[model samples]
Target: MSSRQGPVVHKFGGSVLADAAAFRRVSTIVHSEQQSGAFQHGALLVISACAGVTDRLLAIAQAAAAGKAEQAEQELQALEQQHLGLVTELGLDRGELQEYVRRLCAELAELCRGIAYLGELTLRTRDAVLGYGELLASAIVAELLRRELPVPVHLVDARRVLLTDYHFGNATPMIGESGYLLQKEGVTGALQRGEVVVTQGFIGATPSGIPTTLGRGGSDYSAAAFARALEARELQLWKDVPGICTADPRRFPEAQPVAEISYAELQELARFGSKVVHPHAISPAVSGEIPVRIRSVFAPQQPGTLVWHRRYDAPAQPLALAWRERCMAFRWYPKGNSPLAEMPEIVDTVRKVLELYVVAASQGSVLLVTGPSTGTLEELYGKVSFLPHQFVLACIVGNEPSRWTWEALELLRNSDAVSAVWTGVSPVALYVLLEESAAQSALAELHGWILHTHALQRLRL
Candidate 1:
């Protein structure tokens, strides 16, 4: 019995990895899927750190780097107790489970101690410390899920198979090497025996074997990579939301759900600051032509958003909007006989150095969005500071850019709520920067004029 064919890839994020109840619920889900023959050859599960665990780990690492051993120790103890408590609730064998937990705790403590001794947090050391959360969480979750199923469950460390360059903080994976190692290592053999394999997401190893992490929010990309490597039938990402909505439902109560979207559109939405998906996650999915389904953990049976390469007669209009906060704008005033002529070139270089997204740019000014940062703000041509005004990104997905602006954006122009606008490279989405106070109203107006009304508009897929 060759079990059937290849593996099925399932990824769970921090949202469902919170506590003991969540773990049990996930185990029951696995049982139901297994009983339904969801795993043919085998199932490949990629899991993120427990909820709030990664943030805590980062805090501990930063504290240790700043010579705050007491604070770091307190965090370590709390995290250890949390994990042990989950295992206890699962009723796993206390002896071996406790020992495993103790070993991991000891390793984390030593890593923190080294950072404290050095009194400086280098990217490399930080990568090592951050990886522990996924490591410990994957193991605990795998153990609990294993106890819930009668089938064999194998734990595979992501670092062993997902090979990447030596980038310490944010590493890029080597696809060819990764696929080769995954096969040569026993993933195929384990699957052939109908065993479910579990692994940590967002963590990989360099060619020389030093641990590296795929920056924050890289777990989705990790799952996609494995989906391609394992030649999975489908890639399912379990998140908290129902799926990809027209706008973030939190902000717009009337935002509707999109049943299906192309990979390109989803990638653009993600790049434009959609927290529902990671920006880099679409690469492998597109390359392999795999269908990435976004399913909700709370309502598993509900038809969530499905991302594939199929498109019908649906014409693009305004589709979605994402809000990005705490942004900084850099502007270089044009000066006579000034050497700042290369301001544009400087923007290019700065983007490469920081890897932050350039929201909008004009002759002498540019807006950059960053997720929370610890380092001091880097200055450009102008003094760098946060804008006191509120702002949000309003993105409209449509094929005709000019028509979209003329039809749906007329209100924005008259309202003077717009500052700058840019379209994604593929033209699948139009990004408009808006004033914060008017964001809700502007979004509602756009949604009504463009989507709900559907006048002179093509239906969105």
Candidate 2:
């Protein structure tokens, strides 16, 4: 049932193809799709590690950098043996793959020795070392797939196509130029020839051709890039979760799958640490006007979530709800009439400290909401020794505003979460704050309020 629909990009996370068994599952999926004519246009599959591989690789890198060559060597050999064992389990002639493993192991050993001798592992070197996990996984998965399926598979060096800046561990991609190169170099033509292209995620080369690792969870972004390059009809991301949900299903129990979400909303959730998909993954599809689908690798039959440019046609109020934990609120009070003027400085100070934590932030005049802990914030600003004139902060967040945005503020004003709200600055934003213990109840109450007031419907009318 393979569709005659040209080419689509399918990116599988590390867990999806982690072990020999997972590889068998992947082969089943690919072959079934081809036989059923569902993948008429064929597919470009981007693979990550067998589960738990990257963490071990990272530990070895850390040990090597910390001058523990013996430990690093032992761990590196374990990884090599693990992959070699899986290759054999897949029933592939291990002779060729064994050679590949030897090469990969040799590279790791040489790099670790250098790290141990230098007694340091710089960010650049660490990124270079950690980039191999995805590389090896992609190669092995592609080879296994080719053996079981009729499709010709090409294992691409993502570095050859994905160009980036020199920022070692967290490089930013030159997306526009790279997309142009991919299109010009006939990525479409290659796919049209019925070849399954395989490439590593999370690693790209610099303009000078040096390997650079993308930011954390950058593999999703890499998949998005490939989708845009091929002008794909669909870009599918397979993950552990069944799809985007109204809340963390494990926590909410009653949380439901979101049938669809606008790219804007998905980005908002991602920025708030929704864990559904990388926030950056939505951008390529959004910009290219391509539909990106999030489906569960575990429950592939379910029609997950489709993220598109404009809002969905249906008038469904909100498709999902999300919660972020360990959220910190920074409360500030300025002395007397000057409080308004000092608000800017407080905002600036919060921003500077937050940059170090790599946490996302949203701000109101008197409070800043972030996902970092209070202790972490204190350590970041310890040198400044700047005491807040008066303030207290816990965690505060909710869904779209209810009729009680002002009422919520009033509740905070009269309660003990923080000091009196600053009146000098305009309350342009109505971001709420709550303690971790009360967040769920607060959200439920707010939802009830919105329903009774029909606030969203009223606003529309």
Candidate 3:
């Protein structure tokens, strides 16, 4: 592990590590990388829990808090059995790992009993319960890597180094302090000694060591945080898809993969409706100027999408389309003679409260798009009245969306399937609101138009 390059940070999600076979594949990938001299300076792996484990853990917590201690214990036993089954599938000796899993389960059972007796579930307690999924999953990964790689594999508890605030469910990482702790806790030293480090993602601790989670889908953020701390060469996120696609392949069957994209474009896509990468995951990478590669675990040889700081100078065309269903548009008519300057503050407040996706302000009215969860807007209730209209939001993401905004709007407006449409534009994207019933068909038509138009333009060039 003596080399001229910095270490590489790799993140494997639950979808890619579904079972023992998937874990085996992960080891093979690591082994291949090692053989190719990719880990000369060392490598850090951030792992999510196995598929469905987090949900199951949440259910167990709810059951225990509802005073069904016996049922919670039964579910916990089944979870234990699942891990043991994975151990059997991997053909590993059941002595040490089996005993360790049982001890962890015993502690979980005690917590469940406590919750049952108290009859309450606090976010703090729920976070503690949810974290066990990653703790258990990472242990299995560590063992698998130990058997596969010639170098030493060390399992470091992320809670020891990744410090966050007291926000129980969606805590923000204290990057400066966390970086200092990561170096102080021997993570750098272990890598320098030629050891491959494995750690659980999405879990960190407060100043007093109370466990906290970074919300769902936070593992990508966790991986980026570690990469920033380690100053790694690249941050690789292993997913189940080929790469970032023009649209979700499941919903839009005609969707095609994007070869490369700028950080700003990807950030907008993620923020709007894309699920390929977490919204906050790109910030640290941007700050550190690290290139992120989203690769498929199934097809390891193929070079997937590369997300970097550079922008391409190609002509304007839709790079990708992302949509959100079950959204609502809120229109507010301002009071008489209210200056337009005041709209910005109101929009900012609404965006923070509702996590709004699109906002448009005109002379008389302001419109915002958000999810149906309106109970959180108590503070803004009387300040501005809202007229709710159910709509699905579709965003067209590209480098220079302003260039094709008019053409794209006209295409949507003429479509027989599309009914009423409201539109907004940003530097990187154009947002369209469509009736829920016609959204699917309208998106399909728009996607087809984009592909056909781009192909014809290429021929002319």
- Number of the top-ranking candidate, with lDDT as the measure: 3
Clashing pairs in 1: 316-398, 390-436
Report the lDDT tens digits of candidate 1 across residue range 1-461.
11224777888888888888888777877777788887866888898999988889999999998889999999899999998888888787554767888798999999999999989998888888888888887888788877788899988999999998998888988887898988888887887677898998889999998999988887888898888877777788889888888777777777767767777677767766677886476468657777778888888777688787654555545655555654434444434455356455655645644445554555655465443344544544343435556566666665545556656556677766676676643557676767777766776777766546443443432
The C-alpha stretches of model 2 lying farther than 4 A from their native spots are 1-6, 36-38, 180-186, 312-316, 325-342, 352-373, 376-432, 435-438, 444-461
Q: What is the TM-score of each candidate against the true structure?
A: 0.78, 0.77, 0.84
Better structure of 1 and 2 per lDDT: 1
- Please give the ranking of all candidate structures by lDDT, highest first, separated by commas: 3, 1, 2
lDDT of 2 at 396: 19
lDDT of 2 by residue, 340-410 (tens): 67666666767765622121222432445555544455543532322233221211122333333575564
lDDT per residue, candidate 3, 1-461, as tens digits?
21225688899999988988899999899999988878877899999999999999999999999988778988999999998888778876554877777788888888888889899999999989999989888888988888889999989999999999999999888888888997898888888776799998999999999999999888998888888878778888999998988888888777777777778778778776688886476578657778788999999987788887766575677788888887866777777576576777778778777767777766577777777665677767777666545677887777677777787778877665443344445677777778787677888877887667667766988
Clashes of each: 2, 18, 0
TM-score computed on alpha carbons, candidate 3? 0.84
Q: On a 0 to 1 TM-score scale, where does candidate 2 land against the true structure?
A: 0.77
List the candidate 3 regions with Cα displacement exceeding 4 Å. Answer: 1-5, 309-315, 325-339, 342-356, 361-392, 406-424, 433-441, 452-461
Q: Residue 159 lDDT in model 2?
A: 83
Better of 2 and 3 by TM-score: 3
Ten residues in a row with the worst lDDT in model 1? 452-461
Q: List pairs with backbone clashes in candidate 3.
A: none
